[model samples]
Target: MLQVISLVLENKPGALMRVTGVLSQRGYNIESLTVARTLDPEVSRMTIVVDVDATLRQQVVKQMNKLINVLQASDLTESPAVVRELVLVRVRTAQESRTAVLKEAEIFGGRVVDSSTEGFAIEVTGAPEKLNEFIDVMGSYGEIDVTRSGALAIALDARKLKLQPPVPTKAGVKMEETAI
Candidate 1:
């Protein structure tokens, strides 16, 4: 299953490397990660989306908690979280497709942040699928170039949701390890 992990760590060089190294060593695929300085200069916050098994994820969380620089580690997957990914897409445009392009952006709640006859850049913030759907439609109008921020989530501590089921397997199968 995929997990959204938030880590508060001491701000310092190579700190990101260490955290990512742990995931890599365990053969976990990091879907995306974003690191930025927190309100305090001495600390940084990292949000990472990783594809990992439930039991392994627990161990990873425990290990992160034990790290000297890591102050807090939380799995927000089952929480009532607000998650969003920002995407900037550069689309080639021409007179024939300009109208089509703008209309599509409008449908996706995106703005044409930049534009020229040759091409246009649109910015959209929403769930990953929403951004992807916008991009998919762009192909008919023109070629597309996309860049997106890693997923950001705000956990709903008091409004947590029921945990999700494990990643589905083929032939109507199920996983032995349940996501905590």
Candidate 2:
């Protein structure tokens, strides 16, 4: 099964290499990896998709957490999350078939980002399956070039990696539970 592992890491040099090194050393295949700066400039968020069973998932999460730069790591495979990918396809379009390609692009909520005498570059963003369908349909037009952004996801609930101190209770005790 495919699992999405979201990790929060300190924005420091060699952090990314450390994380990827761990996976590589373990011989785990990464299907997709997307990393970007978060709202906090001192932190970065990494969304990695890997094919692993339940036992391996736990082991991977554990190994990720052991990395000094990794602040938090969680497997969101079973969580309610919004996952998406982006694909830009340049399709050869003739005057005769341009309309058909444009119509199909619209059907998939894609936009013609660029157009030229040779082809039209359409940008599409959605679930992976939707992008696959769009690519399969556009293949008939003859693909000139294609670029894709791997899957990125976030949980629907409020659970997030944070550094705030624990909330205090009425009895002056700190709550051990997480915000989620």
In candidate 2, which residue pairs get closer than 3 Å at backbone N, Cα or C atoms, i.e. clash?
none
The ten-residue window of minimal lDDT in model 1 covers: 171-180
Best by TM-score: 2
Each candidate's clash count: 0, 0
Q: Judging by lDDT against the true structure, name the best candidate.
A: 2
Cα-lDDT of candidate 1? 0.83
Model 2: ten consecutive residues of lowest lDDT: 171-180
Model 1, C-alpha of 169: deviation from truth (Å): 53
Q: After TM-score superposition, what is the CA distance of residue 155 in candidate 1 from its true location, in Å?
A: 1.1
What TM-score, over all chains together, does every model reach?
A: 0.83, 0.86
Backbone clash total, candidate 2: 0
